[model samples]
Target chain A: MKSASFHLNLLKDTERLSSSPVRLRVMLPVVALFACIGMGLWWAILFTQLLMVRAEAQDIDEDVKAKSKAHAEAISRQDRVREMRQQLEQLTYYRNGVRAIGKPLAKLAEIMPLKVQLTDLSFAPPPLDPPPKPGQKISPFAPMTNVETQRFVIAGRTTKETPVVALMESLDSAEFERLITREKRVKSFRQDATAEKGGRRLLAFEVEYTMPERRFAK
Target chain B: MDADYTTVARHFQVNAPWKSISGTEVPSAHGQTVVRPRSNGRPPTGKLPPRLTGLHSLAWKLLIDLMVKIQLTRSKTIEIGFGGKGKSASNSKVDMTGVELFSGESRGAPAVRLVHKKDGWHILAAGFVPPPNGDLPQRWEDTPHQPVWELPRNFQSPSAAIAVNSGMSSFSQASAEAILREMSQGLGDSRPKPHTAISPRLSLKPQAKAEEPQKPAPIGRKSTLPPPGTPVSENGRRFSMRPLAEEGFHLAASLPEFQALWLGRLLPEGRRPTAASIQLAESALMASPLLHPAFAETKGNMLAIFVRRDAIYFAGYRKGEPVLWRRCPGVKGYDAMRNAIGKALGVEEELINDVLEDALVDPRPALEPFLHPVLHQLDLARAYLAGKHSMDTGKALLMGLPYGASHWCHMAEESVKMKLVPGHPFDGITLAKGVDASLAHLHLVALGAAIAAAEVET
Candidate 1:
């Protein structure tokens, strides 16, 4: 006998209320509505965030465009400053290269034993650099290898080799060290056709001496 | 246990065959002819009938559909009414908890829980608890109190099938004789009745009885009673019935519409052990014998007498379908038998059990007075089933007597020529460990309510 045969349930189904406060019959639609609202809010927020990100990206792109020219100008000015500094450094090297030969030459006169009758006193420095070609861009900075070698020649009429040796020995003194070196060779020694005031038949001699190097540097 | 719900529903449909799509008359949900709108869209003729008030008729149809909805709640601990195919007598299925609420005497309701598992039915728990007070809502719009009764830890279930015994409850057929009796008893104090006559509610409310006799019943043939399975109100009484397994007959029940409304809302949910179904106490008692092993031995054909505290009832079953249910007229309950025994044997009322069981005191003097009427009524019922349905009432089963069942059986054999066998309420069910079987007699109606409510075929 199925119980349902005896089941004459007077209580209707609607009377089957919820045990918990949440009634599924009424709450299901309510929860669905709330879920729909929440999704809508989330979509709105996501769309707003996307718009904000797009706007920020555009602003950053425009800002970068606006600042690019100033950056380039600053870079050019910096390049000009660097060039001016390099030119000033080159000038300093030129100043440093200026040989203090005036004092040394003055001392050379004092050191020379009247050169036994001085004839020719000349410094044969290495030949000056070749000038720049026409239309060539010239750099103000000196070349890295700017040291020059010169030869100092002392040619005079002397009575004998002894006075010449004395003159060479006097040139070797410390006061003329920067101006002259020991590297020397006698070019000639011959009897002079012209005599001195006393008619002493003075021998003519020429001596060439290597001079110290002069360098262009920082 | 499987329910005969499909047969019952089909029977109801056949009895009220007004299911027509094109007509204005359609069958009501509860086996009655009612006027309703066309099925859908509009009639094929394209012209609206004058009687078809567009939205009103459509709304009525919607309302009827909504009210007739049947859904099986799965969340309930015992999936009540989860139908399956099988002989309901052998298919003692469902995990149900049955409780008789509002006991009407000290509110002492007995609770029984049955579960089908491991190839058999088990009595998970059977015990008595003090029933909580079930108060109806103060206003029609108010909701009843949830968690009205907090069952003990042992007796509790996720949901419960509730059986109630109310003074205002009545069960009668819609036959002419019964209607004539109803009309004759209108607005008057009548002889005692197992259902309405002796009810405390009726005796207390003479004014209600006076106020409700507005329409005199029809003399004959055109009975105003609602058709089977439909509820109808007349003379301040609400009546509903279901088609009987016996063809062309339906079993009817009545209650004060107020009491029906009250019982309907007695167990509002929102708490543990909410109600899964509700049934009349006598209705439950009538069905309690379905699961007994003896029922199967009898091939689902049997007759049984149910003895309650205040009333005695008879129920007959044919192949597990209830065919006969009646309250024995003029015969009172066991308490009256006790009163007769106390008066005839000059014994104290408390010692009535002793006198009846001892057999030392020949209390047949008092016993005969009580059993004579009951036995006569039983004989009439047995003869009726045999003559009408060709069902042999073969040695009717006696149940819920509490005591003196043997004496009653002996008397029945001698006087009525019918053998009476004592029935155990839990005979077909396996008792779980620690379950109290001693009080099984008290849980008859509760157990029946659970079984019947759970047996609806899905």
Candidate 2:
């Protein structure tokens, strides 16, 4: 019989892995120790930096806070100034509208014939006949639009139809064309017989024209 | 349904020793020791075997299942501690007689016991009650204080105490037999007894039988009465006789058989059958007389250098125990060595060294080149063993057939500077039989392994 022999693979297994568990046991503690040391060092650095940052922050705290307060006050003053400017602009827009009405009124006065007698002058939309319902849908081709387009209405009495025709020609002049379209200058014109004024037969009339719009400065 | 059993609970009222009493501090006496119980109160048990610990629970279960299927006894034991948390000796609720209860100082109130027997675990309640005096344990003081004992200057930690205790215990029980027993236990009982006697074999050769009859006993006793025809003494006690040359014949005769057995046994199980043959050629070297000096000089701290076709195996033996083994790769086999020689000799065909008496041709140049690389590796191997394992290369016996080739043995001897011996192929027994030297050298390692195995077996 042969003497007892050992398998090479078996021998390798016995010797090679014999110290593996021991190595792992030792390595774990070593790794943990290094990690703990690294963490401790990192914490120390962070804490020191925090202390230094806190000191510097304390020194600059009052300066920064005062500067911030002043900045806030300046911002508030700037907002108030902006509000005043906006109010002045709105007032200017209104004043410009009043001034614009004076020129148109002067022009209207120049255009009026002596035979014409004005009873009422107003800035309003022409009254709609049989006002549309709230939910009514206008035809796509309809001249009425969703936009609220204002118009000027004038109600007066004229002595003759000739003065009315002359007044319409004067209003359609180049100077008035800049303010209003001549084609739609008089939205509606009506003539009616009224009681005689100053021993002459009078023609009562109503006229509606495009309303003036005020354009503000950019 | 109304049950007769009713639970009764009572809380013990403890009396205070003092009402906020204060005492003056006093110096403690020197050399005074205090005995404190461990926090867990659980003694340390030895480590669990790696076979159990290395495997996962599922793997263990599978192994157990397989064993059960095969009807094999379970070789594993899993420890289960049954008790209340941190409760040791007092947890078990065994039957207590009246006398045992009265006499026992450690008797506590009755508690449930979970007993593990041959069948399974069983729940039990001890039939004992607490003493009627209402004497309960006092609360432990949690004040921080100095330790009870001072450590020796050398003692590093409390865990080292185990090693110290073991050292002390071993020191006290030290003896040759104890040392041997411990060595045997630690090394496993597989080591061979080198000096053990072999079973004598009956002489079978015709010349040996004639020579045995002719040779007289070295010592003789005179007898007055007519001598018995047989070589039996007058007291009728026969004497065992054998030629001195044949004393270790059985050992030499059994080497080959044992070598074959060891080769088979040492082969790794579950490996592919055709991977490689593990040649054990150390039998002749082991059985040679040259080994006796080395064994004596180092007390069996011998390193066997086994050269094979595939690799060079380095094994360290300390007192017949295989302490370490390392295999160095890239060793050139005999075929390669022979091819190199044939090429150097300008021979077109294979040259077989067949003559028994002719002078052996010198293939030194061809062999040296091949051997130089091997020697370099050997040197590195020695350095590794010395640096890592603390093995003294100078003290270890270096024996291998590779060293015997040409001037390689002398070269190794000079380098290692240890008790180096070129292993001869045969001992006295084989030599007396006049076995061919060529056949002996061819199977040298196998013969050495047999002898080594025989030594271990003996």
Candidate 3:
């Protein structure tokens, strides 16, 4: 049995030595190749999935951007439409206001006396005097600028001596003003042939009124 | 008549007598003066010819009738070329009872006495006689001898006869001399005075009275007339003083009406209608009479309303019939007319309003009629830039064409090979994407062609 056992062991050792190089060279390389192929397949699948996900995200991002742009454009268009509507409305309102005040003003103009002619007329919000300067701030003791009284100054030429009084009376009685705060008259010689021949004088007058604001509304 | 003639002859003899009066210048048997001729019969045959019967005919009477008709009533009368040696003397005897003078005496009745002289018979008043011893003796016949009745009274005045008469006419030189004598005798002591009253008054006054009060002698400086005031209204509102070139609407219950309210309100007092108003009326007439036919029918009504509105508007500006258009506020004739039109057409007012509003706001009409076509071309260019339509046909077709054409077969094959080089690498991407890419490339080429075509068309 010992001799048989010794022969078997020798055979086993030879087989092991020859197969070990073959296994190292052939089996290792084949297994490594199969393993590499499997890993490559797995990575490719992952890469494909990653690519799909990225494409989806890009699509979502583009969709959001497009929607946001469209919304902004719609809002802009709405804003333009609103602005146009407001302009048209304002124009209509102005036209109506002009129409409303047209007749009364024309009648007033017609009844105005021949000697008086209005050189200028302006209509807008009443002017507001500038606020006190920073350095010139009002103190408790400082007198006010008389802001309580709103003045309407009427300046005109007159060939008559009493034109200022007549104008004041007309304005007072005609209900054109609530009050006549002040009346000023200055006499000046008019170089007219008739006036100079008669040696008559004319008065250039500036009359100021502090009228009630309610009269204007009507 | 005989007595008058004798008296006239006696006066002639007294005035002028021949020194050969011893032939027997003596008183008649009844103490009337008488003169005896030196020659007792007709002159010798050579010295005087036989009278022709032609002179005795009524032809000379006809001439006398013509002369009396033409010259008796004239302002001045004259006669010329009288002779007594021929048949003319006999004719003169028949036509004119006047004094006659001959070269020799003729035996005849004392009523028709002939004096020895050189030439003709001349008619004279009974009171007039010639000088017997001077050249010829005068024979006087009975005829009215009033000096004032001799010629037309105008001839008796101190006026000149412009021309002398010749023998061819009845108004002759001898007749002219007699007329001048009568006129000179008639003009006694009368003088004419014209412009008697005012002329003396004006002349007696100062010469400078005609130009007195020379406008105060133009004082130191030239005076200026008063200036007409502001062309526009003094109020803040501007007065139109006329209608606009295009009529504008005053909205009345959402309807456009021919309301002259704005017009009346805007015009200043005593403002005159301007040329703009006339042009506005004309333009309104020339345009479509009715705003649009789709809105209304009965164009006459529309025109009437339009004309009335214009008339009132213009009248307000003119200040003529000023109160005609001053109705209650918000009253609109145009709206009424529009409603009437809608009612006539069996349509609702709202529908008409829609139509009118559309007409008012339609940019199509505003652009087509008012805007030039070049503006439309610019719009098309902008649209083209916005990728609404392609600009080329051949390139587009070539890009779209599959590899089937005969001439481009090689190029098509090369394209296919390039596409297939990756062996279906382009699987997931759509074929349309490739087509779009190709089209984009073709579009570049098409842009050039389109520009060329557009240039040609322009």
On DockQ, the leading prediction is 1
- DockQ score of the complex predicted as candidate 3: 0.00
Report the lDDT tens digits of candidate 3 across residue range B4-40.
3344344545653442542345443233443322221
Per-candidate DockQ vs. reference: 0.16, 0.01, 0.00
Candidate order by DockQ, decreasing, is: 1, 2, 3
DockQ of predicted model 1: 0.16
**Full candidate order by lDDT, most accurate first:** 1, 2, 3
RMSD of each: 16.8, 31.8, 75.2
Q: Name the runs in model 1 displaced over 4 angstroms.
A: A18-22, A25-37, A40-44, A47-51, A68-218, B1-93, B105-107, B134-147, B176-239, B456-458
CA lDDT, candidate 3, residue B182: 20
- Per-candidate Cα lDDT values, in order, are 0.66, 0.35, 0.26
TM-score of chain B of 2: 0.32
TM-score of 3: 0.17
True contacts kept of 2: 0.03
Q: What root-mean-square deviation over C-alphas does model 1 reach? A: 16.8
Model 1, residue B175: C-alpha shift (Å): 3.9
lDDT of 2 at A118: 84
Prediction 2 TM-score vs. true: 0.31
TM-score of chain A of each: 0.63, 0.54, 0.37
lDDT of 2 by residue, B189-272 (tens): 212322111111121233533543243222223211111010111121111110111111111111112222222222122211
